[model samples]
Target: MSKRLAQRADSRETEIAAVAADALEGRVPAGSLVCGDPDGVVEAALGGPVWNRYAYDGRPAQPWPPEGAFPGAVLRQPRGWGAFAMTLHALAARLPEGAPLWIYGGNDEGVTSIPKRLEGLFGEPETLAIKRRARVLELRRTGAPARGGLEDWREVVSVGDAELVSYPGLFAHGRLDPGTELLLGALPKIYADQSVLDFGCGAGVIAHTVRRRVPEGRLTLLDMDSVALHAARQNVPDAAHVLSDGWSAVPAKRDFDLILSNPPLHRGKEEDFGALEALVRGAKDRLKPRGALIAVVQRSAGVGKLFASVLKNVEALAETPQYQVWRGGV
Candidate 1:
């Protein structure tokens, strides 16, 4: 397997494609399952193979795969360890006897424990390929192990008057986020008939609270992570949920009275402000003339400058020890 891996000048996406192509040629049988490919990259890599492309990110609301047994599968390792572990269980439980389940991820993508984790599940995991800072692991399902399923990771938390259900991978899972609490506290008393947009509606915490506060307000929940959206779908069932890449998934012509977000500041272990910056810059276009973008962020993240660059006026509505809820508008 090591000999088959060769260093190549290819983007991460391309490396992922190469891995997929190789799997199709050898281990991964035809009509196998593909998990967490919301972007359809794995399917495209296999040259449009007929397979169950199970994706969760908010973009498309595909039902969870059937709970029957499957011959084999190829899965992209998720960034969060909890999500990754949950995915491994999800794949393993559905695998038939002696079926190979290929899990792939970059080192930086938080899959360093593939060996130990897979060993506990499938006796021993086979290293398939190691190239371009990425590795593919092969685990053949053989026996049942005492592994906690996704249900074990589930929790119900009460915030304000709403009880939100969240899984391990979801942001702030099993706990209330201080920033979101601050943002929710800072929100105006009444929304009435206004339209509300929860930009990064993790577990629909903000959406649920706001809906209770403003029952007449039309709520639209958006998030790039399918896990978050999946939780949001249940937490705020009546709200319009959208799976999008930042502002791309939202319709430009559809203006909103208010935009609320507790935007994530990190991508995996790296500190990334791309999502937050995009939200600030793009909010004006989606907001009505009097509409405002309200967000809770770390005060030291220099979000004021970001808000100033996009909106003519920016106001810090509330501040805590580590967070500030800012409101900006044209």
Candidate 2:
């Protein structure tokens, strides 16, 4: 990894610690709301037994802002601009007038640009602290309740013959991505009764394609993001959905005849191969004896080596200047 990427990978905990320290030092008020806190770090730092929590991903927390009043809110900035904006809007709508909103994030995650987006709904933010290349800012809810409901952000896009419903912050939101289009075009024929799992399925595009090809086949869609999964549920209602981080929430007894994806490569602003690597390594245990795992990735991802390490009969199914499709069978 490059020096910057290495620092990004290593600095998450440190950045969270810095935010937590500020929260503990009286920046965050008691009975505050919180979101994007991995492992509840900020909540723990606040010395609270319980706090109103919201999560966009498949964490053990509320999917929407809780109904009630809060003295303030502490938000760990989300990766995508859409996710962050949605969360901010939701908080603004729910928080009482003058309630403090404490937002913090790494500089690389675009912490400094937050105030610009807050122009209408929040007062000018006060810079609380800047440490460990991370920053914390305090602002008060000012504008009238903004339209922050999930339906408010809904978008629909046409892909081939299908119209997919998606929200912002989702991969390739409102359109089909080139890598996925390549993967779809090059997909192998599916048997009518085969079981297929769309690993890291975003908005169920891959699973939807598989469904049209083999309507009788049992389909499963898995992803960590609740918002994307919500869109997937609308687009492909027949497929079983699993909100999980990797295979953590998937039942071990379940196995698939085929698994496919255009796997995610980035976590926040940094290139993260951990999820992709884990998916490749764990496919062996999740696939049936003759099942295969197929995926599309950037040409430079070096995914072929990982596929070869665990899966037998690995081969490149298709290739382009910018992307490659790989398939590996057990």
| Most lDDT-accurate candidate | 2
Q: Which 10-residue window of candidate 1 scores lowest in summed lDDT? A: 1-10
TM, every model: 0.81, 0.91
Candidate 1 per-residue lDDT, tens place, 1-330, comes to 111121121234466646655655655667677775535667666532222222223344332445666777777776677666776776777776688877777777755687766635564777778776777877788777634355565778775556788876778777778899888889986567788899989889998888777777799998876667878898899889887778876777547989999997764444667678878878888998788899999977878877887886798999988999999987
The residue pairs found clashing in candidate 2 are none
Model 1 whole-model lDDT (C-alpha atoms)? 0.72
- Residue 17 CA displacement from its true place in model 2, Å: 4.5
Residue 283, model 2, lDDT: 82
- The 0-to-1 C-alpha lDDT of every candidate, in the order given, reads 0.72, 0.79
lDDT of 2: 0.79
Which segments of candidate 2 are over 4 A away from where they belong? 1-10, 47-58
